[model samples]
Target: MFITKSINTFGSYLMLMGKVFARPERMRSFFKQYTKEMSQLGVDSIGIVLLISFFIGAVICIQIKLNIQTPWMPRFVTGYTTREIMLLEFSSSIMCLILAGKVGSNIASELGTMRVTQQIDALEIMGVNSANFLILPKIAALVTMIPFLVTFSIAAGIIGAYATGWFANVINPEDLTYGLQYSFTEWFVWCGIIKSLFFAFIIASVSSFYGYTVEGGSIEVGKSSTNAVVHSSILILFSDLILTQLLTE
Candidate 1:
């Protein structure tokens, strides 16, 4: 039974991907949905991202300074460290983890509630393709917005680092500026952007899958929401590790 269930789940995933790619009509609807989700995922999340990024940058910069004491501890190392952490891990991996908790759970619960209320079945009867209509837009929106969000996150993190350097007096303002200027690299930025796109897909698809497959009553909806967040978070972490290995090596 367990093996059979696993196969069925895997088959469902393949079918979902196939449907997403093969149907032109569905793609149009998905695009429309994407616009709506963009507002929710990108615009709505800006404040939180800003707040988190600021503190993260400051804390990381301070911590790095505290740990290193050699004359060879280049002033530019601060900026390089910030850029490396933000580009490789913070913007992509950590943001997804936050989204999995906030956005993923929300998507699952909303869809699950619709399912329990028979709204999903109503859509089906009305000839609406639930996956294409509901899920696709979210996927599209995430793919489109995550890179932009990462950019904001990177900027905010840098500002935070600057604030810490100025306030703590561990590094001179000119030195911090020099570090930031010296560490700037296009490849690191590109890697972060790519990771953001991948994370967007993972969060949207996983959340939508849980929501679409929801059954039972309100209780089940709650369970599905929890599952969606937990599972999506795990997948994001695993994918980050894989991508890091591939990209860094």
Candidate 2:
């Protein structure tokens, strides 16, 4: 029964995507929506990303210095490890998981509310391709802006690592700098950006699916929002594993 239900849901999701990708009736309206989503979904998220990444970077550096570092281990290892973790996982996968809660829930609730309030139905009554009109801009905005988020996350994390050296005295600034620059592969950064793009799509599309398909009252809208966050988080993790393997190899 679980497998059957899963397959059915997947089929429905794919069918919805078919409608979502249809050509927009008015390019002007689509562009306007695209700009709005970019602001609402992407730009507004910058503060949280920077704040969280900074703290996580500091914590990761401190943890390594306290627990992982030893007499034999190089001091630069703390910075190097922090860099690798941020570039390879945190900025891309973990950050997206965090976003799945914030952004995903937002998307789901907005759509679910529309569903319950008959707003989407009203659009359909006006002969609008409601799915495309409503969802495509969000998908595009998220995909376009995720790379910038990943980049900002990396910078904030690195600065946080340095902050620990300045204020916390946990690690040497010189050693941390050396470690961050040590054996740096530019591809690791690109890998993170690439992974984030896919994660963004999963968050937007999956959340939109739950919201757009909602079939009940306000209570059901809440349920769909929760489901959107949970499902998007799961998909982000699963895809992260696959993407890491594919990109690294």
Candidate 3:
């Protein structure tokens, strides 16, 4: 029964996506919504991304310096490890996981509320492609802006690592800078951006699915929002594993 239900849900999700990708009736209106979504879903998220990544980067640097450093180990290892963690995982996969909670819940709740309020029904009555009108812009906006978010996260994390040197006297600033520059791989940055693109799609689409298909009233909307966050987080983790393997190997 579980397998059957899962398959059925997957099928429904695919069908909805088909509807979502249809050509828009009005390009002007679509572009307007697209811009709005870009601001709301992407721009609004930059602050939280920077804030979290900064602290995480500092913590990672401190932990590596204290716990991992050895008598024989180079001091630069802390900076190197911090850079690798930010570029390879935290900026991409972990950041999306955080966003899954923030942006995913917002999408689910907004759509769920619309569903319960019969706003979608009203669109259907007006001959609008409701799925495309509502979901496409969000998906597009997130996918376009996620690369920027990943870049910001990486920069903020690096700065935070350096902050440890300046504020806490944790390490020599010159050594940390050299470590960050040593053996740096440009592809790692691109890898993070690429992984984030996939994660962005998963978060936007999965959350929108739950929200768009919501049943019942306010209670159901709340449940759908919770489910959206949980499922999106799971999918992001699962995909992160696959993407990491493919990108790295």
Candidate 4:
């Protein structure tokens, strides 16, 4: 019964997502909402993303320094390896997974509140296409902003590596710069961008799905929010694996 019910719910969620992409009744309304969501999801999130990414790069640099003691091995390789890690996954996949927790819950709770309060029903009664109005803007904003966030995270991580390695005497500036440029692959950068887009959709769609289907009041809203974060995180990791396979191999 549980599996059956889960499958049914998944089916319903897929249908709702399809409806979200339908033509908006008012492009102006959607555009306004899109800008608002972009600010909320991207600009507001910059500080936290940078802070975390910096720490990630710093730690990677230290780890590389501590592990390699051979004279034959160049110290600058740490910077290059750090760059590869950040570009390949740390900046994009990991950052989006974190945002899944932050942004996904926010989206779910907002929509769940509207659902329990009947705001969505009222919108339908007023002939407003609620899904297109409320959800499409969010998805659109995320699709655009997340790639930018991924870029920010990459820069932040690189900056972090440079700062920590230079100040701590762990690696010289020239070596770090050389390492950063070592075998840099454009394919890795493209893979990160693709992962960011896929993760953005997963977060927005899953969050809104749980919220839009909520059946009760405040307690259910909270539950929906929690479920949104959990489901989105899981799906992001799963999709990351699939995307990495397809994009890389």
Candidate 5:
């Protein structure tokens, strides 16, 4: 039953996506909405992403320094491990999950409230492409913003590791820099961007779907918001694994 339900939701979500991209009735209005969403979704999101990423990187460095048993193990291994983990996994996956809760819930609740308040009905009454007007801006904003956030996260994580290591006397500056630059692959950055794009799409689309399709009152709107976060997080995790496998090959 769960599988069937998921499949149905997936199909409906894709249909909704099609509507989201339909040609806008007024390009100027669409552009205005897009700009607003870009600010709300992207610029507003930087602080939290940076804060979490910096701390995680700092903690990882401290933990790495504490973990090695062998005196022979290079101290710089901390840099490599921290870099790989932050860039490949934490920044893309964990950050997106955080966003799934923060931005996702907000998106769902905002739309859900609009639905429950008959704002959506009013739009349709005016023959507006409500989905396009409401959802496209969000989708466009996220796609543009998430990759930028992930890139910023990677940089912030490395800086955090550097600062923590330097101040805590856990690892030397030379080793940290060497470790990050060691065996670095340009492809890793590409992979991170790819994951961020997919995650951005999933978070926005899933949240919007719940918000747009909500069926009832304030209580139902709240439930839809909860469902949006829960489902988007699950999908982000599941898709991360699939992306890792595919991208590695």
Candidate 6:
């Protein structure tokens, strides 16, 4: 019974998403919302993303260099590994995790507050499509911004890894460049970008669903916000696994 209900709920959610995409008014509202969310997700979050990406890049490079210190180890392995990881996983997956904490939480809180305050209800009463008006914008914004954010993350990761390699003398500047050039794969980068797009959709939809469904008072709103982040994060992880498997296969 529980499984059946869950399936039904998921089906309904998909239907709603379809409808959202079909509506012109919702599309317009989504564009407006997209602009606002793009600023928050891309521009405002840049500092944190850069900091985290840099540290992650440095740590991974250092660790790989230390572990594979054999004389037979290729000089370019460090740079190649770093680039591969950044292009394939770090840029998309790790950045999405950060976004879950930032954009996901914000979406949940905003929608939860509106739901608790009866603003959503008021909009419904006024004959507005609350779901289309509120949720579509968030989904649109995230889908638009995540790809760009992933690009930024990839660039930051590469720079960070390069700096660490230079400082540690693991690879000379020319070798580093060669490794990076040799490691470049358009397919890996494209895969990461696709993953980012899927992640954006999952985060926006899950968070908004929690917020839009909120009931009761302030306490319930808070609960919804927490639930939104928790569930969205879980879903993101699950989706990531599935996407990885599919893409790699």
TM-score, each model? 0.91, 0.99, 0.99, 0.96, 0.96, 0.90
Give me the runs in candidate 6 sitting further than 4 Å from their true place.
Answer: 1-5, 15-19, 26-30, 168-171
Indicate the worst ten consecutive residues by lDDT in candidate 5.
Answer: 67-76
Candidates ranked by lDDT: 2, 3, 5, 4, 1, 6
TM-score of 2: 0.99
Per-residue lDDT of candidate 1, residues 38-137 (tens digit): 9987788888888899889888888877786357877778766776787778977897799788889888988899889999899889887766777777
lDDT of 5 by residue, 1-249 (tens): 999998999999989999998998999998899899989988899999999999899889888878752479876688999999998898999999999999999999999999989999999999999999999999999999998999989988998999886788778889899999989988988899899899999999999999999998989999999999999999999999999999978
- The candidate 6 region of ten consecutive residues with least summed lDDT is 19-28
Stretches of candidate 5 off by over 4 Å are none
Select the stronger candidate by TM-score from 1 and 4: 4
lDDT of 4 by residue, 1-249 (tens): 999998998999989988898998987888899999999877888888999998888888878867864578876678888999999989878999899989999899999999999999999999998988899988998889988899989998988888876688777878889999988889899899998999999999999999888998999999999999998999888988899999999
Off by over 4 Å in 3: none
lDDT for 33 (candidate 2): 100
The candidate maximizing lDDT is 2
Tens digits of per-residue lDDT, candidate 2, 116-198, equal 89999999999999999999999999999999999999999999999999999999999999999999999999999999999
Write down the lDDT that model 2 would get.
0.96
What lDDT, from 0 to 1, does candidate 3 have?
0.96
Please say which candidate is ahead in lDDT: 2 or 4: 2
Query: Which of candidates 2 and 4 is the stronger one according to TM-score?
Result: 2
Residue ranges of candidate 2 with Cα displaced over 4 Å: none
Clash counts per candidate, in order, are 1, 0, 0, 0, 0, 0
